[model samples]
Target: MQELQNVVSTAFANIVASGAIEKAVEEKLQKTITDAIDSELRSYSDFGKIIGERIKQSLQINFDTLGLPGYNELILKIVSQQLEANMSSALTEHIQERMAELLAPAPSAIELSALVTEFIKLETERAGHTPTSDEFTLIVKRDTSIRSMRFEYVYLDPDAYKSEYQCKYQIRIVDGVVSNVTFNEVDPSKKLFIGRLYGFERRLFQLYAAGTELILDDETKEISTYYPHCD
Candidate 1:
């Protein structure tokens, strides 16, 4: 066993000294991993073309017909109404379904920008002076349960937050009306603070709004976050 170990060690040492291991790693892994990383970093930019193609193929409606996205639903409704008479009800309903399912979802990445804007707006209001994006930063975290109540006014119960964040809040978020989701009469317990929520379609997210000292710098400390893949 001792002799065998020595022989194996000597062989490994020779392989290392000859640069075979380094050559093998570079040839096999390094370029592949670098490429994978590059692709992942660029994936966000591809979202537009991929989604545009999907909408174009599925809806067969040119976005050039409807201008910006803000009035898309309204404009689509009018366009659909105009074209509805030409098409069957079944086809009309299918387009509506596609609109609801695909186009209605505003991904969390979009909301992150909006969240920063909202924060800046509020900070400006509170301090009576406007601060630059460099003034303060946001800390986003995936919340399994409702943890931050400072921003979430109605969702006070930590125990019920799990059920609401998972179930009821999910329902209210339909059609991407994420300005500030409030539970009026449907479920008294389930309401979402738009400021607190920094989430994708299904997952729940919360930004640190209460006590954490906000210092803005993407160049310095990369904000720690757990974001699920956009579905």
Candidate 2:
């Protein structure tokens, strides 16, 4: 269980360093999130019945209505792509609007931050353990105009023992492709970037040409975070 917690923490950190994500596990998380958001959107739209019918009708017949690969499956696979390659305030507003449809109005930044922090804390508590000091300072950036994400988490004990992770993701909507992704770090240096990029090339195309964008979510949560942004 401790290993799983570490893996989860490391996984998020890897996403921060390399703007890329996998299609499998990401979907599971998104499903829960989407369900909540969808309820909110439905309430706001006031056309919940109609919209629900549309969702069922659209998806029940035409496979394309489901969205890429397999609709739900594709959403899991491509959500990170959207985060890395096509992020923007407009996207955030749109999502917020969707949330408003079924849930209460969007939470303020402070409220959102508190919610996120509590959620993470709850996860740690559920595991019957505590996140290390550095794990408390997680950072996440999402940009909609270009769609991508970058995030990091670090743990440095008072004795100077340290563990860190970073991940970055880039998505290309034009071709429905992931252009680049890299994660994991020990002693970071310039040379490390090359190896990270090389590993990404195995799965993506022309990743070297892209410049990553990291847009902080003002609503992010924190606990004992070292960075002002995380705090």
Candidate 3:
């Protein structure tokens, strides 16, 4: 009987050492946790709805403590107002500047003398001539009866070493402005007198001979002649 009891005790010790019971318990606990999670997931939409309702109720209860509009709405409103204010200020400034320009007086006749002087300089330069201050003379004549002005200038070509080549300009001005400046005649033989000019300068003179208008900018002091479909 004692041997039988010892044999039974040894069998129990072996079963415990094999860890079957502990493994079964662990498996059961894991299965229980998985099933619980699956069930909760199946009802997750409903759970979220309920939680969202509770949170909305809490916010409503504390509405007075917080602001009327939410933080996002308030920030958006502030940003919108600032943008509108900036745009309005810019528009106002632009309108004022335009109005001032519209109300400004026309440039005076004296201011136009500079235009004549520039014309003479550009023409002389185009003719391959640089005249000293003493070698050139400008005569401006205003005819109020015809509402026109005439500019006459004579210059001695500095490039001519063999003989003094005297160049002359007669510019007509109407309405206190001049748009087109051209030679009295387009003599291909004049190239011989002026020597070879740059290709661009030759083209410019050709266009002037062809009756293209010369565009002048008073602000930038730029002179350009118009050529169709050309820069």
Candidate 4:
């Protein structure tokens, strides 16, 4: 396996040489090939020259096509959406097969959130971007076993496009298992949050009207929740 330092330094070199960052840094802000990389990776000098070219090649292609200025923001939005869609399709297929094998009779409720998280893991593998864990807060509720839930949300960069949007969605979950997932942004409205959701969607999950945390017991399948308004 390639060391992390070599990979990053190579990636930086490619970025600089590709003209992505070059336009941003002029003569006054000149940076050496070594200075472009972080010091922490200095010790890994052995791997730098050998693996650097591979890293540079891979990074240059994407930066050349997707980086700001190189490509319009709208195009980047489309690329992101397509990638998300591909990831979602792949995730859904894996989840379906895995769930069948794991649950013989099939569980009563599959948490969509849990399944979605799992799908994201798989999708990240396929995309081969820097492996990163998904980080976004999600809240859901259901009176009965959740049949399925889908989450969609969008984020917009106001400066990029006055009329564009980014959209994402999570799919089919019984109880709470997420069966499918995707992340995408597009040029759309100014809305900070927007998306489609199905299967027992809640603005927020409140254990009680009194506004309290809800605790669940795995063994008993019992829930103890409190809401502030109830009190």
TM-scores of all predicted structures: 0.18, 0.19, 0.23, 0.18
Candidate 3 global lDDT: 0.47
| Model 3 RMSD, rounded to 1 decimal | 21.6
For residues 54-95, write the lDDT of model 2, one tens digit per residue. 787877766677454757877877887787667777778877
Output the number of the TM-score-best candidate.
3
Q: What is the lDDT of every predicted structure here? A: 0.41, 0.42, 0.47, 0.38
User: In candidate 4, what are the lDDT values of residues 23-131, reduced to their tens digit?
Assistant: 7666426555456564435546755654776687777755565555535777898899999988998979977765453333423343334333333444334433432
- Report the Cα lDDT for residue 159, model 4: 18
Cα deviation in Å at residue 53, candidate 3? 12
Which residue runs of candidate 2 sit more than 4 Å off their true CA positions? Answer: 1-111, 144-231
**Lowest lDDT 10-residue stretch of candidate 2:** 152-161
Summarize candidate 3's per-residue lDDT along 197-227 as a digit string, tens digits.
3422343344333433322234422322211
Candidate 1 structure quality by residue, lDDT tens digits, 1-231: 999999999999999999999999888798899877667656365765676677779978677876766677889988988887767787778767644543343343334344444433443444344332222333222223544322212121111213333422221221222323322123313434222222221122222111122222333224221121211
Instruction: Name every residue pair that clashes in candidate 3.
Output: none
lDDT of 4 at 54: 68
RMSD of 4: 37.5
